[model samples]
Target: MLITGRTLRSLPVLAVAALLSVQLLAPYATAQETGRTVSVGTGEPGYAVNLFGPGEVTVNAGATVTFENPWFEPHTVTFYGDTEPLAPSDPTAPVPTNPGEVVEYDGTSFLNSGFLFEDPFQVTFPDEGEFPFVCIIHPGMAGTITVVAADEDVPSQAELDAEAEAIFAQALDGLKTTAGALAAQPISEQANADGTSTWSTAVVGGLFGPSDVQQFFPASIDVGVGDTVVWESTVPTPHTVTFPAGPPPFPEDMMDPLAEETFLAASGPNDAFGGSGFVHSGVIGLDWPAGQSYEVTFTAPGTYQYICLLHADQAMVGVVNVSADDDDAEAQATPTAPATPAPGPAPTGNAGLDGSGGGNMVGMLAVGALVLLTGIAAVAARRRTAR
Candidate 1:
């Protein structure tokens, strides 16, 4: 039990080293104990239609799994059997004619994350079995969690991360392709035998594929005040045409029946700010024959920005520039379509946490360890001087 000054100084060094090691291994240790962290939804360009990252995961029994949603929209992680069967439709084509149905989840007896939006939901597995889940809001999105015995081996964090990256890249590419296709379609204007011209554009979503990439054709358009513009839905999924509300108060609910009345009440020319009250088409689901169309006449002359409520974060937005000039006569004589807007670059991996917090924690820990080591060195030097 006699300890030398040199040994005492070395203790601090070892302590600092151990602390640094624990800091570095914290995430992995947590992952092993609480299963793995699967991103519920990749926000922004991809939206929440795509379920868990890696699509599938394996964890040990008695471990907890956390599902984190980085997107602003709400999504659910519900066990597959708990949900109703699909109405018999092609998975590779647009969504089925049926609208999103109500599926209940009580968090137990059924394992579900009711509605997650920018929050992490955790569930524990006590038995060894494969649990398949899907987002009730977007039934097309699915994933599975395989729970094995306590001693079973699972994919490491690096493997899961790599798989997630590849999946996200593919999702982003698909979104860009859908957006580009919709943007390239030319706006059609039918001249009525009377005089007025009806300008129309298709609001498409997964019409040609199984993706939930909703977008407004010709993202931007120019029209004279008083001209009516119609948005026809070609995809099976529902969408909303919502306009921004100016200083005056307006309801934010796009699905409200009163929303259409409010929009019509504000119809006419725009004020100085280019906004004239709020306008929303409510939820426009697909219809047979001609499809569902929502027409709005811009009374005031100003630029109006609108978005599809479901896919706004995915950048499904459109603009309407209303000019003061009356061009009904010329539009009736000869209709000319505007040039298609160029598609923007695909969204890079801007979905996940940018490592700022992790970097800050590491930096702080390193600084603390360095400070402790410096103190140990100073104590050792003092002990040598005393000797």
Candidate 2:
């Protein structure tokens, strides 16, 4: 009877233990359902390159952003715009990882900073803005996060138009002149001439002319906003004008070194207007951003200089002073083959060199005999023609 009474009392205790287990497990199971999954991988494909499975994830407040570096490369999973890195160390214990997520190399770079462990990104936005970040080692590896205010409405059409117009003006009005053309212009830049206007331009030898390339012409040039410059090459060898620097980004660096952003003008073997020098068909052609032009045109309001890569010293430089204007332009083919001198129409000494050739032999012999008496007359006529 005593054993039966003891068993009856233990039943209530057992019931209490069962109730405690339910309470502990319920919250954890709920957490997983609400949590979001972000990824950090090599951004490449194949087993060698693991990608972010979800790529992107969004969750309500108090939810977690789980990051997994599935590949061998070290990765970081940090909150954008946050002061400190995520994936903090656990003094008491190492952070636990889910299946398929592994932490590899601990390089001094940010990846090893322990910024992407099981942790909270800790921030979310209600308004629209962008957050861009990158993996320093691999170029072109970057991601952005944008948040939009739930209540904010999109901008009207007028606002968008104004923004585009502003950008258009920014790109034009900054090109310099062409290769030899800039050389001939006033180098001193003053409305008046100064000693500074003079400089020995050795690069002009490539242009074909024996005349020394003087300050009278320059290899390249740059200009301020709303200006214009031109180029005309003297060399029969086809030359091109190209600007290496790309289009303007901000207002400060708008004028790149010359007007071309890429292949502006693709001239035929007989034409001009490419980067630095002329390139044949086997070579890649010029390709610039903002826009390309062989003829003179304002390239979005900036200073630009182009030169011949082939003949550095001759056919060398071009300047385009692009400015804010509606004027149009195109790449014009350079005229005339300087190397191939054209044939003339006049008759020559060929007849005299001939052996018994061309027209009446007997009459010619008689005329030759009569020439003894007419030698004096012939001499007089020759002297008169010489005078």
Candidate 3:
């Protein structure tokens, strides 16, 4: 029998005997625990796994499940069953959810773990059913949890941890290999008719299976004065190539659905960048009529750094090494192929421009090109009539 603290202190002899008896008769406790843990995000530098480790998990009713985030990127675990999510009042703020509180989720009410960071979001499942959850910020990131009767056997926490580790390890390994291959590619350059040269570099290379990499291929490039660098997106995700004085500026309406069309316009002066002030490509890969590409001509020589605002916290950065001396820059550059012109028709004013006068130049160029095309068409019509 277990004695009370007061009784044990009063009679040491009797307490010792009681404790010995209990210890000899008591069974050894096992290492297995009741609750389950899911790792939120994991990967090396410049790459991240948006997927929840062990995307599928099994648990018994009344058992607690914790979602832990240990990465810089923000993620949410939202359970939306046959209902659409309403627009968030504050784009940067997270939705409300109780941490460490046990809720008997039955798929009727929406449950959200808003902007999971260093803290773990805990919830107890009392109802036995299959529930699906997703990270709303990422398109294909999702998972499922199966709950059964309390008496049914389920995998222990150790087993679940091992499974999640193996899954992320395999996926991250494949992504590392793919990213390295992409980075090995050389920048392509073409000499234009007006004597200026154009250098082309790929943005966010491509997708690796279920993972989408957030890095600039060949993270560093060397270019000379009067050279134009064109960043072309090979992936579908929207990314911006921004050069700022301090931290990059993320627009308040970044997540607003209505700002879709206008958000892709280029910002700052695109005419020339002398390694000063702010320059941004707005949002690239937005299904614009002109294929995903942003150009900037460098006028002065200096070391410049740029980053993708969306993934900068994840170390999605690149370096542009510009040299005033054309010979030195050319010697440093590794060119594999010539870059073709930006495809599709000229972008209209509807593409939207920022207040920095960046869009004005693009609009003027578009109008001039349209007028020139119309005049050429009219002359061709007259020549055909004479024939």
Q: Report how far off residue 192 is in candidate 3 (Å).
A: 1.8
Residue-level error in angstroms, candidate 1, position 207: 6.3
lDDT of 2 by residue, 1-387 (tens): 001112222223322332232233211111244343344442110011222322333333333334444222233343224433332112211222322343221222222213332232222333345544333222233454333454434332233234423432222111111212332333332221421111122222221111112111332333333223333334322233434333212111111112232222343332222223222111121222212223232325553444333222211233444434422111110132211112222131111101122123213322322221133224334544656
lDDT of 2 at 278: 25
Best first by TM-score, ranked:
3, 1, 2
> Could you tell which candidate, 1 or 3, scores higher by lDDT?
3
Model 3 over residues 1-387: C-alpha lDDT tens digits?
A: 011122212222222232233224221112326778787766433556777877799999987788876554567777776667633222422553655465667776778887776567777788899889877666677899899999999988767777877887777666665665565556777888977778876555446764656667556677888899888876655566766432222343332224544345566445467866556676666454335787889888887767664554444556677887777556644343212111122221111111122234223322332332233234434544656
TM-scores of the candidates are 0.63, 0.20, 0.69
Predicted structure 1, TM vs. truth: 0.63
Query: How close to the true structure is residue 287 of candidate 2, measured as C-alpha lDDT?
Result: 26
lDDT of each: 0.52, 0.28, 0.59
Question: Model 1: clashing residue pairs?
Answer: 268-299, 268-300, 269-299, 269-300, 270-300, 270-301
Report residue 357 deviation for candidate 2 (angstroms): 85
On TM-score, the leading prediction is 3
lDDT by residue for model 1 over 259-356, one digit each (tens)?
A: 33432232223222346455656556564222356787667787676655444434445667777875632342242533355323323221111122
Residue 374 CA displacement from its true place in model 2, Å:
99
Please tell me which predicted candidate would have the highest lDDT against the true structure: 3
